[model samples]
Target: MKQVKIAGQVVPAIGIGTWHMGDRPAQRETEIAAIQAGISAGARVIDTAEMYGSGRAETLVGAALQPFSRQQLFLISKVLPENASRQRMEASLDASLQRLQTDYLDLYLYHWRGDVPLAETVAELQRLQTTGKIRAWGVSNFDVADLRELWQLPGGDQAAANEDLYHLGSRGLDYAVLPWQAEHDLPLIAYSPIAQGDAWGQQLTTNDTVKQIALTHQATVYQVLLAWVIRQPQVLAIPQTSSVAHMEQNLAAGDLILSPKELAALDQQYPRPTHKERLDII
Candidate 1:
């Protein structure tokens, strides 16, 4: 697996996203096995949130991680927008930590901008970092303007990454958001890098160029799509799966380096943005 430098830490280029993991009791065992498969395949980063199944995903992660050394994983969890206030954020982190069965998180994030001020949130995150509660902190669904505004805050530069919707069809971030993060050496963590598993049904998978690349590499269209997202050095993609087979496919995709010709063909099929557009979020 490939690794990237983000927030002064080296981590896997692709992580596991546990969006709907612990919601169903019957599927719990399968989901846990899938995560364990990802870890066994060299995926060190695991992203979850308090909002995900209302912390049920965190609980699943805690149980799945029991077999591995806590120090070897980079655990990330996000606080909901309603809990952005200092006191509420603290409580949320504490609750997440308890559910995750960990002493500290590798990275904690604000789910999205809310009524709470960025400065206040950043201040609280810094305090948590200072107290060894979290290694680093970041924001999600922030646009270029939001990033600019955050940069002007008292301790906003401490933000480690900005996670948003990024896939073959959703390239709005390339216009400005991605460039901004790259300039600051901030990692652009892409959630739903495969478009919530809809990429296979979308035109991206059916395009002739995509088919050609898949054929040339002896890979599935979904794997090609996943590869395209993590092709860049500044980007890290988290694609969720409930099956160990898909987990293995995703990890393999991280290593499929696309050629310039293949990349150009895909670019022609899905052109990059020439002007700024509103960043897309799930």
Candidate 2:
């Protein structure tokens, strides 16, 4: 239950991701249990998006969070790129709020860059903040250049965070995007920290390096991967889980500290960025 203060709000270092939460009817009960268990275990941040399961994820989150105190939870949701225009963004926000059964979101993000003008979208997001529909706002899947352009706008200074695919294998953001956000004091929400269960195929969890580290700590390969992502103070890793057991394991990873040598070993396996590279998105 480690906490990180980002964009003037305090949140858990490891949040619960609801990417494919409500997609399958058979898994609904387990999904709900996982979310509730995470919250009860002191995971305050929960992230979801309208595009996830076509909004069914948000609905499930709403139902699962009914008994919790809204003020204590850091709820986040994203608007699709196509719906980022001013009018559509507003409509989408309302729909998301209804589905979440909440009056305001702790953080609202633009899913990705779209055809909509950045200035207009920033203005609308600021307006939403003014009206108390959202507390803070940010972007997702934005690289350094996109972030630079975003900051050029009038209300862009209010940008809170940027989220993208960040994991042991995908370290592109370690080059420029991460440093830029750190300089601005904006947190980077790392989605797919385990590569959406592709970590096994990518050798993230099965490789000798990871295996050795896990053995040293008596931890699972998954915990080692989760630990690597959130080892930084300013980064937040949201790894989705449907089992309460896995949810507890994810929360415990917040305390899994990696030594400099172990980190170096990982770097050798998945080299950190040397020069500017396009951000990775999932």
- Model 2 CA deviation exceeding 4 Å by range: none
lDDT of 2 by residue, 1-282 (tens): 556886687878999999988999999888999999999988999999999999999999999999999998999999998898877888999999999999999999999988998898888899999989999999999998888899899989789889989999888999998888889887889999988777447867778999999999998888999999988878899999999999998998888898999999999999988988777766
State how far residue 178 of model 1 sits from its true place (Å). 0.8
Stretches of candidate 1 off by over 4 Å are 199-201
Model 2: what TM-score?
Answer: 0.97
Provide the overall lDDT of each model, using Cα atoms, as 2-decimal numbers: 0.90, 0.90
What is the TM-score of each predicted model, taking all chains together? 0.97, 0.97
Q: What's model 1's TM-score?
A: 0.97
